[model samples]
Target: MKDSAVAPTRVDGYAELRDYAVIGDGRSVALIACDGAVDWLSWPDLDSPTLFAAVLDQARGGRFDLRPKVPYTAARRYLPGTNVLETTFTTASGTVRVTDALTLSDTASLTPGRELVRRIEGLAGSVPMGWSVQPRFTYGAHAPHLTRRAGVPVATYGAEAVAICAWHAGQPQCTTDSVTARFRTEVGTRALIALPYAYQEPLVLPTHAECEARLDHTAAAWRQWSDERTYTGPWREAVLRSALALKLLVFAPSGAVAAAATCSLPEELGGERNWDYRFSWIRDSAFTLDAFLKLGCAPEATSYLWWLMHASQLTHPRLHVLYRLSGGTRAPERTLPLSGYRGSSPVRVGNAAAGQLQLDTYGELLQTAWLYTTAGHRLDADVARRLAEIADFICTTWRQLDAGIWEVRSAPEHFTQSKMMCWITLDRALDLAVRQLIPARHADRWHEERQAVADFVETRCFSERMNSYVRSAGSDDVDASLLLGLLHGYRPSDDRRMSGTVSAVEKTLRQGPYVNRYLGPDGLSGSEGAFLACSFWLAEALARCGRTEEAVSLMDQLVALGNDVGLYGEEIDPASGAFLGNLPQGLTHLALISAACAIGEAAR
Candidate 1:
């Protein structure tokens, strides 16, 4: 092996949003560009401040770079049935394979500390590879001090420390801010790099062989987890990949599923729609429960239910739309000082939507509770009582104006989707009560309110002009969320009204093959990209409405829209086919899985 130090090559601008793949260790996730740059990472935990923020602001944000010194064409994929990412770089002279993963322990559990492992193997002639390891703490707000511990590079920022160890034939040149290494490898040679983070603790460097073994175990664990999934249907690969992505969003300690790994990745480029999604949203609990339950993962549902129960206790069973992973409610929204992702200014840290009164959350929470009980998971007395109280709250407060399901910042309105969900809240609660899943304290009252909500939606929300259900009372605008009426049984897919609503949505909200949330003003200045999840919802609606061929075609298009590694962002630009918003979005994966499952069921 030949060793030398090379000056780091600066990344000129941001990589395309779709050009990154994600790897995680249950606790945190990292986004790696196709060019082998680990650009965005939040270590120790998913919601923690970024340790590497290069993906957001390429010029000032920090990153870890690893790639060939010469020009190369790249192809990447996740190892089958696992989240281990493998990228093959082929140059005119040689080819190399890079494997990336967050290391797991022997039992296939997240390692006690933050550990990222990268392995490279030469497949052809000799190739020169360059790597730079730089640490920027606290979302690039803190510059760490670098030192060597037992010959390994250590980066310390206040109480947090990360140690980097390498196993190769090349020596690394280390500075106070970064470590750079360049090496030439021949056929059959391999190299390894490991970085582990600890909070105010001495670094324990793992041997290269030990790190390699850990990688093998981690892959095995992921494969075993994937193998347990019961979705052996059409688009099994897509479904499994989505399931893996959703699993990555699960913060194992608390079982709170984050909305996405990275915050402030913009829904529209150069727009203010950037918002942090590292926290769990109560509104997502129903969709997440449906996805996980369908994929044969009951433990996640149980854990989530426990978290919900515990979190409800904090606020006296009054649920908010979102909460921190640790069950804290104070996620004050604030803009960071750094320039946003690709000049999308005002990078927001916490989500202000947490305080919004989205009445749909009552329906979502009750629906999740119903799902939990139906899945053979027993709810304790306290949990049952808390759920009952939630339903009671919905009964009394369903008529209040709310921010609706979309969490619009505008004045409250009687959104049709929210009304339908209020109906679902009572409907699911009544169903569970009938089965003695919980005490039917207000069954009669819930029944009356459920019917009242249905009547209100039918009489007030439907528009004869649009020949379909509208976004709100007295409004003629169709929302993509109306597609969810089919899933929630608010309307039969074959009903003429449902058919009309579907047609209206297609006419108004559909843009080519994608679907926007709504065409109306959302109280935001710039327009948002097509919501990927809503597009999936449209596919599901089509499948349920007996348009099998059209649904399959649409589903195929939506599935193919995913990035190379089968991950999707929150939104997509319809014309450019560029991913937008926070990436590897849980809602997108959940919707994809749900739509595929619907299509599979329809086919059968």
Candidate 2:
């Protein structure tokens, strides 16, 4: 081993949520901070156990650091039309540029064995840099043993293995704990580091030059893929960035998109609202498909349809609200031992909402099938039958009380949003049947039930005193989800009742341009940041209601709220503008895309 002459630099306790940006290779993602420390990453797959999770527990959670040793100021941005992250650091001594990416193959598939490439180039005078590679498997439950194989440092813990290769003037010193290195680069000098992970397989070390070449190829692939996006409307940059973020969450092998890359990033700091979002949520996927289809990206929509069909096949054609990326039905929620983000204890894995009877899911699934057909993709006979069965199930069960779209932990209530979505299921299914995309077995019954659902919601969910729809049949509280009524076609955007609900939402849920999912208790103790998606929904609703000027103003503000890299988290603190909850959240990105599209259409 090389001499341990240089001591490791200690990073500050934790990075602000907005200070991190994500890069992925379709299979997994990494959260790299502005200071060039990789604080969270999961290899092999998005749902896989985290290998580096210092974002949650700074002291015990592992990380990989690669940054200038001297004090420096940094600025970062994504390469145009790609997920490649580039951060430039300037110090009194010199300047350096670091480019990071989870390399993709030439065919745009995730590179085999899940490789991450980081390249550092000298921009001017010589700059000293420090680096470390540490792996803590299973959320810090297991520590890997480090050794050198073929002159490349490898870390192994049970069935998992990862190899780190570096192309630098100085050699890395491998201890049992980590691999550390220090080096200086002068003008025209360059260094490359690649880390590839494997499960129950031997590590394959690649030359640093080969890894550097792969980075260029990956960036080209991303640019090519992004060029296929069909949205050329207002806020195009924001829309494209959101689309790219959604692409990062997709498990390419299965076409199942994770709701977000990380789990247990608290919705509220020091709160218990944190839950795993790495699995595919039916509602989120349905909305994602809608956004992709609107952008003329049919391939992603088709891939999601296949994933849904396979998942339904495994579940006997019965749909759960969420499912594992591999099509499994079980997702038992459990708390981990590690300290949560910002002292939020009992970090969670898996989601209990999978078992809840979320009535909105049927509408979402049927709507997705309708979108698929509209995109000119023919559904196989089995898939068609499965979709019909799902619609049939919703027809019979729409009257029952269940969890609402927010996935409340309280006793199921007759949420107005659920009823509205049930109405949407019948409406979209009727359209599909009329188009002959599927057999209209219960056309008359569906028409009848659809009207009945509308009447029931109008009667039971509306509040006379408030002159708007309430959260549920009896409750008088307003929910941001009610803004979706216009988007779902539950009522005309100009209708008095629909307009009344908009007014109610603005009055109760709006905190400037942000909106809370709900003000009432959600069977949880602490408060959460304003849900970013709900605010976008408000903007869409406003545009659809012919409030185009107001919508455009809000759109400008919301678009500017994104991080410097044009990414959003699940929520944002209204007062401080700090990101809260999971970074690069899919639902949030989808909503932003939808809002931008709505604004564009309204403008035209």
lDDT of 2 at 447: 91
| Superposition TM-score, candidate 1 onto the true structure | 0.96
Cα lDDT listed for each candidate: 0.86, 0.86
TM-score of each: 0.96, 0.96
Clashes of 1: 0
Q: After superposition, which runs of candidate 1 have C-alpha atoms over 4 Å from their true positions?
A: 1-11, 107-112
Candidate 2 structure quality by residue, lDDT tens digits, 226-264: 999889899888899999999998889889989999999
User: Model 2 lDDT vs. the true structure?
Assistant: 0.86
